[model samples]
Target: MRMLKRFFLIPIVVLVVSCGGPELPEEVALEYEALPKTLDFNQHVKPILSDKCYLCHGPDAGNIKGGLQLHSAEAAYSELSENPGNLAIVPGKLEKSEMFHRIITTDPNLIMPSPDSHLSLTNKEKAMLVKWIEDGAEYKDHWAFIKPEKHKVPKIKNEDLVANPIDNFVLAQLEPLDLKLSEKADKETLLRRASIDLTGLQPTLEQIEEFVNDESPNAFEKQVDRMLASEKYGEQRTLDWMDLARYADTHGYSVDRYRDTSPWRDWVIKSFNENMPYDQFIL
Candidate 1:
């Protein structure tokens, strides 16, 4: 009789929980499935928070709303003592979390970004936030502030084929998916690729013949060194920076007049050829 009674109660409990009650009850946990797994804090959740919440809740001390700060990992998890809510984030508990509640609530006064502030979260963003909260609300350092870490090269079966540590890492990723790197380009094709990349121009027929005929083991490296020595390489590299510096043949005005910016332009081209350190180049 007790066994039958417990069996009968399972459906009722599941029904109550599913219709927005509490966390999944352990009894029906196996049967009930969550929505598709999409709870990455960095990739999915961060962009939504940055766009919607950061303006009012972010690092700018002068404009923080409700004494909440969501910019840093520390602040997001902090308690909203001054505000009406208690905890801003109660990890692994979405229903009890105030941030999650404010976003999901239909009440105009309770919704986040506030209707008066003209900011709102889409259904998809709200779902992501819910899942993030349920997944322990893990936080990562802001991407700009994160320091780069050196990764150990992955060991792969085709050790002989690996050209460098970079190739080993790339091949390791591809190995799981049954893919491999394509074959090396022929000499003529390689020459053309290098020329265009370094000088912004295709290799001449004479240059192509010279590369194709070179039988030395260091032939490709020699060709690369030669291209780097060319004036065109410097000229091609500095085009973007020149544009950013607003270098032009003439002053950009209605009464346009020629400008003497050649000295600055020449300095850029010279800096590239000399392999100037980035800090010194900027200085």
Candidate 2:
């Protein structure tokens, strides 16, 4: 598939705790073809922790299972009383890092995500954690919770080709790589792209004809407006929301019986078409 627009690099932030099956050996082999120069704490480590460790060791103070807390850097790295050593993680020294030792330990009793929890880590995840600690175990705020900031739009040589500040930002990245943006698609192509993206269907012949013949500079913008207001827009967005909600084919339990969720699904489509605010949509 051809990319319609150049995508600029954007830094993402997520708050997650590391959770994996077992500790890795002090001399663990890296799974990557090349080791990353820098490991992102929020991206690589947080999700693993969030999935496996957060229930017992996260922000909820009352539910903290062990005295150890891995959600925050201050807590995760602090010395724990149960372990022989004081520090849970010792930056830049994997062998001395107690957290690293526990996961890599072959002793069944000593492995984390304890056998009872039925959680396990892949070799790749273990390597990432190891690399992260070796890189100094830095922690930062989760990306989502951070306040949104306006970034300075980058300057690019292809100023005439850019449609917006976003395009300028994308072009700036491409300039350094010695790459250039593809030519804009014709009006008929644009119509089809917009239709499929927003409504999951192609533009009709008449719609294509009208768009191609229109000479107005804002013709494409009008088409975008049309798709956003279309009934199919609601349907398309509802399908995306379904994944986020973890909608499944059957009841996710022992019985695994089929169930009806059409009403709930329909409500989602209705809310989307109504253009509900993000906070209200979650509520």
Candidate 3:
């Protein structure tokens, strides 16, 4: 009887051990082979400005903000470079580019798009603009530029030391700068980082304790999956949609009447939970 029980327990132990195996680190590899060393203005910058900013500053509109017109490539170059007050863009210099400065400025007086316009370019867009100016604001035709070709992954001295491919890409860039990557975070730090990233809120003491005690290899991934499946994910997504739509519960005009838009809010949340494609939402 004792032998039979031990034999049965061996399989149970193996199963538990297998389930608790340590998970491999997530892949951090860069998909792109290369990033553009220089930015072209006419190709990249013109198209972006035309779609987002031309409505206000384009030709046929007399109200050119700060006497600037970004409608035509020539107009944009002339207005930006010819600074009578020494306030225009000096190609290859960001600090000298008043156009770039105004876009990034938080002060209402210096900020672009003004109060009347609700649109604002994202940080990524602003960064691209700054890079373009830094790259001498070179204007070139679009579609003529070819996409970068895939090259062999560059060799690093301590390739064995790298836990994932992302490290390789990062180290490759850092190598040129003579910089080193930071050390791997501690277990506590890793857990906290994962928890906060997976769920917006910090983990509770009990939850933290449970995760720390869990010996399963895929424990962190399991926690991530669980959090993503929770109702809070839907709620947070709903809040994101609300921000994008600029939805408010009250009308802004004189009467300032309270509006019952909670139903619509709930509808957005439901759509997100159902994994509705963004194109369908627009339709």
lDDT of 3 by residue, 1-283 (tens): 4532221222222112223231111220121113256556765688767766777667755666445576654666664322334434567765555566566555564455554677776665666666676677765544434455576776777786587676788788787778888887765677678666645567778767877788898877777777778766677777867888878867845676877778888888778777776658656
Over 165-272, each residue of candidate 1 has an lDDT whose tens digit, in order, gives: 888988887887799888999888888988999998999998899888989988888989999999999998988778787678568566777777788889999999
Candidate with top TM-score is 2
* Candidate 2, superposed: residue stretches over 4 Å from native: 1-69, 89-145, 244-259
Scored by lDDT, the top model is 1
Q: Candidate 1: where are CA atoms >4 Å away?
A: 1-150, 242-271, 279-283
| Model 3: per-residue Cα lDDT at residue 66 | 44
Candidate number with the higher TM-score (1 or 3): 1
- Model 2 lDDT per residue over 20-99, tens place: 32333434564632455677777888988888777767889887754678888898887653433457677877655666
- Between candidates 1 and 3, name the one with more favorable lDDT: 1
TM-score of each: 0.56, 0.61, 0.48
Q: What count of clashes does model 1 give?
A: 0
Question: What shift in Å separates residue 97 of candidate 2 from its native position after superposition?
Answer: 6.7
